[model samples]
Structure formats: structure tokens, C-alpha cells
Target chain A: MAVSDEQARDELGERLRKFVGRPAAVAGAGKDPVNAPMIRHWCEALGDTHPAYTGPDAIAPPTMLQVWTMGGLSGHPGRTGAYEELLGLLDAAGCTAVVATDCEQEYPRPLRPGDEVTFDTVIEEVSGRKTTRLGTGYFITTRTEVRVAGEPAGVHRFRVLKYAPAPHRPHEPRQQRRGPELHEPRRHQEPESRRRQEPAPSKPLRPRPVINRDNAGFWQGVAERRLLIQRCTACGTLRHPWLPGCNACGGLGWDTVEASGEGTVYSYVVVHHPPAPGFDPPYAVALVELAEGVRMVGNVVGVPYDEVRIGLPVRAGFRRVDEELTLPVFQALSSVTAVER
Target chain B: MRAGERLEPLEIPVTRTLIVAGAIASRDYQDVHHDPELARRKGAPDVFMNILTTNGLVGRYVTDHFGPKAVLRKVAIRLGAPNYPGDTMVLTGTVEEVDGDTAVVRVVGANGLGDHVTGTVTVTVPGANPEATP
Candidate 1:
């Protein structure tokens, strides 16, 4: 009497469930104590200049709750065999690929510099098999408790999907296949027309900027082909994106200063997936640090997305994206203008 | 911190270097975040930004708008669209509720694909006055 496919699945799930409630890691210690260098590295990578993350009284960015617990490329010493055995079972069951899908963090108390961090992890749950754009897979969730000196500091809940790759359709070229999915529940159905590669229905207009009372003047400036930066009347500090008050002095009074339009690419990213309406994919968006010492985000024109790099000199240019929308974009300058800052 | 008050929108360009750098910074060595070739083999067109990076971006958006003094108490985010290189994620937030110095902000980070992250962040701003006019 041969076992049916359903029976095999049930057995596999049963074995997987046994791992739940079991300890995945016991008393894992952070490779380093909470410190400033790691925080600085994190802030630089994300382009975050928030002051609270630095100085003598600095605390790690609350979002970095998970970074301290990571074992890096070497792997964690406290990881028990149970977690690996669980993964081995999944691989044996043909679920070889994995992708992290979700994360939820709560900071009960800030992890300050010099706080020794330790954590414990448990396999919280394992979902039943389900089919997704990537293929069939199981969702595995783990909950971790982080502590400093045996005092609760934070909690992190993480989830991932382990699945077998969906077999490719023989007729379609690999490049034409859909991009990686972020696991949105409602976008399950791919329109037949899209799958057939019909001329993408007429492009949609660019998304309009969300203008409020505080930032309306900035948009007005753009319409007139001038890039404006907000200056605090009290502290003389310059800011961007038009806030209600000055971050430096908390002053409510402010005025506008026209930008010199000259700037350098402080940082940048290339957008590749979930194609934007009205724009082609793989365009470069740069964080241009203006000559006046304020930073603003805009498209880096006159260069391919791949060629856009840090320290690239740029000059602000206003482009009327649509009848109602005029945006400030940066024109990449020639190497002759790329002076080292 | 009045209810229904909206924060200025923040536009973040999703770049290749950011994706790889963020992954490395957070110790997330997932191939989908750095190795494009391996990512493609695993069924991704190209490497995508990891969730940790998205979380950090969201945190930055909130604190940037609330001023540098604001401290985050909790950030519970759910991922939607994948933030692929060459895209932008516009982060917008609304003050849903406020009590003294603490406020709960409903944040949504939308990219070209759609909402990349949606969650509520609890933050406390020292000496925040709810009666102050905008």
C-alpha cells in the first residue's frame, strides 16, 4: 500500500510542527557591545543624519534592534541544531529557497552605548503549504527577545518563506518573466494581457506631489523654475522639504532661500522593480547635497542609472512632468565640473 | 501632535548601492539583496532591498519629520511591494493619536509598485505641545 501525496504532506507538516515551540537559539551574545561606530555605519548607509544617534549620550537607532543580534557571515554560536534540522527537513521536502518577508520590532527601552546585548530565539509558528508567485512554500515565523543585563530591551518578530521555484514556462524568455514579488495578497492575478507582453497600456501620469500648507511654497517655487530651501529665521539654519518649524531651534518663523542649483550626489539608489507609472524602469534618483548645505532628492538626468555615483556634480533643472506637475531634477555635470568636495 | 495632522512627504530613491550597503550594514547576507545573479536564479529579476533597510528608512522618515528629538518606541511594519533598485519609495505619515509627549503615527511607504511598507510607529517627542498651531 503506497502512501498518497496528501499523506506525505501531512507527515512532512507534522514533522515540521514538532520544531515549533522549540528553542532555535539559546543565550546568543552580540558580537560587540552597543556602540557608536555601528550606529554611524547604519546611519551613513541609510543617509540618516538624525542627531540622537551620535554624541556622548547617543543611543542606537531603535530600528537597529535586530542588527546587534545578527551573527554576520560567520554564523551565530548559540544557534542550536534544532533550527538546522528543521531547515534540513524543508530542503528534503523540496523547499530549498528562502526569502525574508516581514519584520516587526518594539523597543521597550533604548539600547544605549555600552549595553551588553543578548538574545534568545524560538520557532514561533509554521504555516501550511501555500502557492505564491514564487512557488509553493511554507511561511516560518520566529520571535526573538533581546536583553541587556538580563533586562528586557526589545522584541523582534521575523517571518520568511521557504519554497521551491515555480517551473518556468518554456515559451517565454527568462528576462521577460515577472520581477521578484514582495508577497502582496491582492496582486495574485497577473492580467493575461500583461503576461502576453502587449504594449503596456498607455502610461499613467506621474504621481502628484502631496502638498500641504507647510510645503506649498516649495511647490510654488518649483512651478516658477526655482528650487527653494527653508531657512530658520531664529537660528539661521537651512532645511529642506519645508517643515513647520526649524529642527535646530524649534522656531516657527522661517523664510525661503533660492538654491544655487549646484550640488553633488551625496548618495543615490537605482529603482528596478514595481515599475512606476509614467517613468521607465531602472532610473537613478539621487540625494543631491546642494552648495548651500541643504539636501534634496530628484532624478539624476543626463546619465544612465548605472552610471550615477556618489560625488557626481549636478545642477538643478526644472522639468514639467505633466500639465499639473513640475518637478526639480538634477542634470549630471561633465567630469570637468566634478571637483572633489 | 494633533490627530489627523499630516507629515511632509519624503521621497527616497531606491539605489543599487543602497540595497547592497543596507543589506551588509544590517548583516542581512541574503543573496536577493546583493548578488543579482543568485537572486535571479531564485526567481527575482534583480536584487531587491531587504526589509531591514525598509524599516530603517521608515524610521528615518518619521524622526526626520518629527524633528531629531523624537524617539521611536515601536515600529510594526508589513512589507508589500518589493523596493527594487531604480525605484522610489515616498514615505507619508499621519498623526493618528496623541497623548502628552507620545504620539502614534500611521506611516505608509509607497514605491512605484505600490505600498512597500505600512505600519504604525509610536514615538515620543520631549516637550511636544499639542496646542501649538501649525
Candidate 2:
């Protein structure tokens, strides 16, 4: 068998960028006109109760621009042959696995109920062959323009990495001796100190919070060692994280309410791989439903990641990891000792 | 505005809570954004940031600059590198063109690794830039 030529691979990488700027989807209309059911499902799934998405003056969330353009289970109408060919080319080059990496949206006007939506997507840019943790691949970016009744309403930029899956590394005998997942969750106990023992991280720190006008107040409450959720002044609805307007009533008036710090883990994931800087791998992160009836995501401490289960009782606590950063975390309370609340 | 006007950079600190909260807010259930062990198996060095969080941040960056009234017509951004927790990302923008209330601006968000997000945004600010007035 002959080894593949490296130069030929480089040429394939160059060929991808040429497809940029070509229209990938042309004049595709959404199957369903924008309506209440879809909007309700979306907000419910995200746990967003902002009042703007309901009632007579309802507007869809701006972050949902791509949702309106989704082809759904049936698939999209405007997908062109060229887009297929582009994927085929990459597949032939051994880049078959794909994962959505990021997306961007710009809204000129909010989408309203009963609006008929149409959109077109262009193959905006294709990157050079780049190596990522998953494998070597190119980044394909598509720009979509969404229109409501022939008027431009929003634009969405979506990108994905289509890569050849990374080869699995043979495990050390010690690692092989243990069960795949059971041994991992314990390592999160001493994250920062353990990080000091590992080799230097090749990547930068993880992305941070984007504090702005709508959400800055929430962070300030965290700094002051309090858990705050937004409460609608008009309808008495309590919301978590925070939003500019109430989705329940479309009320602009809101005030902050302190939480009781006790909650239950609604769902959780015991992360096992991808050890990171300053954090021990195999940690558990949970979506906790606060006593206030709003959910927030945070790390679950005081137990092995594997011990964190759905419905586990937890209490909020502040962990000042460093002088610059303090996070709101939850400590898993032992279920064996306490009676059900 | 001509091509050279720059928007002030916003400095943001990445925290574990930020990464997890942003992921949930966007309805992304991917473990890589919240769980370290799963992320390791997927080949990430640590639980890394997700693209949705970056998209939301970029949207906030533009709106924060244009004030509350400005409307974004288009935001086309590309992700370059992974943003891990414990790092800072600085977002900055420059106006590229202005025509009749619509202005095109180039935005770049740089973290410790390199550029995290780079894109162009088209926005309409009713009465801000002199050149945008017809």
C-alpha cells in the first residue's frame, strides 16, 4: 500500500476555500409560518419565560434566528447541489465527522407571531486544513439572510468543523485496569492543585461571561455573595439568570429577589474526559431548580461527580477560587442522612 | 463614519459559572461545555467554551456599542480558537462603511490563544454617524 502524498492533501485544503461565497441555499421558505406553538416550545425548552414571546405583541427571541430557518425533521428546500458536492469532496478526503462549532446572528427587527419567514444561505467561507482535538479538518461557515414577508429581518452565520476522527490512543496498563468511567469522577476533588502537576495546557482559558446592560445586575449580586433571580414587578413571575423584559407578560419593569440557596439537581452530567487548566477532569455540572422555581447551571461540589444524581438536594455556596473570580456553586447534600423535604 | 472608527474594547473574564450558564441559556446540552471528563474523551484538553456563548457575546458587544436603539441587520462571525475557562477575551470593533443609517463594522474578539471570534456586523443606528445620514 502506498502512503498518501502530503502535498495532495494541502491542495484539497486550498480547493475548499474556493467554494466560499457561493449560494448554498436559495430562497427557501419556512414550512410553518412563525406562530405561538413553536415559540412556546422554544422558550419552554430554554426555560425562558420573558413576556415578549407571548400575547398580542410577542416577538421571538433574537438568539432563535437560526431556529426559524431550520429545515426540521423533513429537511430544508433550498439546499443546493454545490453544498452536497462540497461535503462529498471533504468526505473523500477522510473528513467525515462533523460538529457545529459556533453561530452568529444579527437582528434588524424582532420576529413577530404570524410572520411568514423565508431565507437564503451562502457558503460564506471555508478555512484551511486546521488540526483540532477532534481531528484535522476545515471550518465551513454559512451566512443566512432571513426575511419576513419579503422584508429583511435577521442574518445568521453558522459554522461547523468537518473532521477526520482522531485516532484513539492506547491506554496505559494502570488506566486500563480501572473501569472506564468510575475512576474519573473522583479526580475533580482537587482541580487547581492537580492542574499544577500536569503539563502546561496548549490552549487558552475557557470563554468567559458577557456582562452587558441586561445582565450586569445579576453578576453584581454574585459578587456580593447573594443568589439573585429576576422577579417581574407586574405579573409576579420569577426568572433566573436575568433578561431585559419579562417573557411572561412583556413587562419591562423588574426587580431582583434573593434566592433561598436550596435546590434539587434537575439533571446532571459527569464529565470524564478533556482535562482542563485549573480544573480537575471528571467533574459534575448540574442544572439546579432553585426553590424560587428557576433553574441555573453550576458545578456540584461536596461529592464525587458520579454520586450526583437527578433530584439530589443541594445548597448554594460561593467558591472564591481566586481573587479575581468567585463562582456560585452547589454542594450536594447527602441523601442518606436527610429526610425528603 | 468612515472605515477607521474604532469601538472601545470590552474586557470580560471567563469563569466556570459563565461557561456553564451561557451553555444552558442557549439550550445547548453538549457536555464539552460543562463537563470536563467527557470533553477529555472528545479530545479537548478541558471542558471548552461552546460557539453559542460566543455568538451571544458578540451580539451583546455590538448592541452595547450601538446603544439600545440600534438594530443589527447582519452579524457574520467566524470562530478561530477555543476559549477555555480562566482566560480573558477582549472584544473590539471598527466601523467599515456607512450608508443611509446602515453601517458595516468589523469585530474581533481576542483571548489568550488568539482570535476567538472575528466577524462583520451590519447595523442601523437611527441618527448616530454623520455619514450614515442620507
Candidate 3:
């Protein structure tokens, strides 16, 4: 964990230069689609089940508060998310670019289940610094706006220090806010109009499969339930998402296949960091092996936050992620099946 | 394309006949959906498919009817029953409403027995970005 002062400063400067002034906005305005159990898991992990967030009225999760602040850059696939594509850009530039060495949060809004939120974020500041262990790192300041459909949710500020000695966790600051969820469905416009007028300029026409009626079914399935994999009968191999042909056997003909929900954990990471949308911090994310023998990517849910492991078995359940898609997800096995290795 | 004019119907045939083929789906991972015993412990009356893994089925259904030009903007649904291994369910959608640059539709999934979920879907077209004026 020991490194030079100048080394850290230069690293921070490089990442800041890449994200400081850019903006990202999602096209086709709508809600991020809230799931009730996700909110419950979030609350259980972070230990913040405010009545407003879980009440029958249902409000959006606070982390989902970050929907739209990433202005004008949705056009570029690399810029769809404020920080995600930036990491790729940094990686391409030859920087290891690990995320925040440390962070702190202050909640301005208490979310109720089912409430829609619109968000926008900005790099509040960026600077270089040396850590206690002589590790040099860069710090970034981010601000996010949380809103409901067209209303207000909360505002959050995050500090990210990257490429340096890991910092210690700080005590969480407690705050208060309230609301209700059990209401008649209200019309929503999650993607603020600004997204349409603000696509970050990028080169057009990079050849990729065009999604028309023939392929609309694939995208439509994602909005519902069922994970569709391309099966190559020629070699008995499974393929990735939206593949035109089988990569395994060079099979000219292939068919779509579905998975049985049960699976095993391949690997897992406990998110002790800031919570992501519809997710609370301290949740477990695992690469589960589906019963089909095909390893798949998905989130593990409905278990104690403190007891997740590498080989813990799990099963699949689902929730409405939005109006069009039902998320295929997993829950931990109970009793002895739930016992960790 | 005219408003509410559905070019085709999106259908996904969900069957457990699929063979496992990667690091994603493994052996100990087998439960009733793959290994019935494991499925029971996971709080299910039976083994089912992970919702995310099955996303491609619904996506293919929409693309089959609409052509590759459609960009799926949003999807929302609730789980009605378990999708088991070998059993098949059909996922379907029909364009319900279209305003200016957007089309509102309802998508449903059905198994051999009957309907699973009947929900609404909204998609944005070339110029349907704006819903109203401030």
C-alpha cells in the first residue's frame, strides 16, 4: 500500500481530466423501474428501512436518485453512465483506474416504494493528494439529483478517491426524510426532456446489428421474464446475448433457449460501498451457475447481509424492474442449504 | 409507421430443453429447474429460470415481429408462475397505442396452461422523444 506522492497526484489528474466536463443523459424518458424487494434488501443491508421507503405507497430507492444528472452524453455507448464508460476509457488509455478509495454519504430524501425518481450528476471537484501510507491518489466530487416522475426525491454528494491505498470506512451520518407509496399509478416521465436535446456528440454509424421487428422480440424479452441464450445444435454450445450466429461451433443455424432458475455461486463481491439504484450497500453480487450448466450474470437477493459466500447455493425469483421488463434474479437458499462453507 | 399499427407479434417460447454450456450454468448449480432438491430449499414450489437469463427470449420475440429497427425502451411485469425445465411458455406483445413518436403496447407471457402476465409497454420511435410541452 506504499507509493510515492507524485504518483498518486498524476493518477488522479489523469482520471479527472477524462470525466470532469462531460455529461450523460439516457434517451427515451421513463422510470428506472423500482422493485419492492430490492428496496427491502437495500434497507436491510444499510439498516435504513424508513417507513417512507417501505410503506405501501412505495417510493424510489435513494440510490436510484442518480438517474439523469449525467447530462448530454447518452449518445455514446461509452458515456451511457457517468462513471462506467469512463472506467473503460481509462482502461483503454492504460490506467488500472480502481474506484473510490473511500466515500461518505448524506441522504437528503427518504424514498417510499414505487415512487419514480429522475437524477442528474456533476463532477463537483477533482484534485490530487497523498495518502497516509504514502499512496498517491486523486479525489473526485460528485453531486446527484433525486426526483419522482416529475417531482423531487433527494440530492446526494459522493467523494471518490481512486488509485491509492485503500482508506478506512467512516461512520455513516444519519439524516431524516419521509413519504408514502400506496397510491394509484401516476403518469411518469423519468427521462427528463433534456436527454433528447443533450446526447454527447460521438461518431455515427459504427456497424452493429440493427434492431427491427425481426429482433424486437429479443429486446422485448428482456423487458419481460426469461433469459434467452443462443443454442448451437451443431456443437451443443450456448452463446452470448443477441448473437447473430453461434461463436462456439460456427453453426449456421441456432435456436433460442431458456434457463432453469436454480444455480451455484461462481464468485461474489459484498458491496460495502455506496448503494446502487434499487440497491442498498452491503448487498451480495454473485456470478451464479444456472441449473442449465451455463454460468450466468445476475444479482442474489433475500438473504442476511452478513452471511454471503463464494459457494452458497441460490434460486431465481423475479420482480418488475419497470413497465416492460421483469428482472430474472436469485434469492438465497434457506436452512442447511443456506449454510455457508 | 402508423400509430397503433403492429408490424408483427413478439413471441418467446420458454422451454427447459436447453442444455447447459458455460462457466455461467454449472453442475452443483443443478436444481429441479436443474436440481429439484435445490429448488425446494430456495423457497420455490419448483425450480424456475433466473429472470435475467431469460431476458433474451422476450427480446427475440419482439425483434421477430417488429424487425431489427425497434429500440426496446422499457419493460415492467410480475411473476405469475414458475418456468420449469422442459416446459414451454410463449411470450407475446401487441402494439396498443402510439402518440406522435411513441407506441404504447401490452405484452403477455403464456404457458401450456394459460396467461402469466399481461402488462403495458411503451417504446420511443425516431422522433417520439417528447411526450408534452412545458
The most accurate candidate by TM-score is: 1
Per-residue lDDT for B21-75 in model 2, tens only?
A: 7665454556667888766544566766666667656766776787755666766
Please give each candidate's TM-score: 0.64, 0.48, 0.28
Superposed Cα RMSD, model 2: 23.1
- Sorted by TM-score (best first), the order is 1, 2, 3
Model 1 complex DockQ against the native: 0.21
Worst ten in a row by lDDT for model 3 chain A: A174-183
* Reference contact recovery of candidate 1: 0.54
CA lDDT for candidate 1: 0.78
Please report the candidate that would top lDDT against the real structure: 1
The residue-by-residue lDDT of candidate 2 on A1-341, one tens digit each, is 01122123567778888898898889988777777877776655433455556788777756667766665434557777777668756654446445665566778788888888899989988988775544567888888899998899887777787765543332223233232211112221112222344554343334456889999888777766578999999998999768988989999999999888889999988777787765656789999999889999998865567889999998776554432455677866552111100
Candidate 2, DockQ to 2 decimals? Answer: 0.10
> DockQ ranking from best to worst?
1, 2, 3
Report the C-alpha lDDT of model 1 over A40-135, residue by residue, as the tens digit.
989999999999999999999999999998877766767778887677555534465676777889899998999999999999998776656565
Q: Once superposed on the true structure, which residue ranges of model 1 sit more than 4 Å away at CA?
A: A1-9, A170-341, B130-134
The per-prediction CA RMSD against the true structure, in angstroms, equals 26.0, 23.1, 27.0
DockQ of 3: 0.01
Task: Sort candidate 2 into its docking category.
Answer: incorrect
Report how far off residue A274 is in candidate 2 (Å): 21
Candidate 3 deviant stretches above 4 angstroms? A1-15, A24-32, A46-55, A58-110, A129-134, A164-341, B1-134
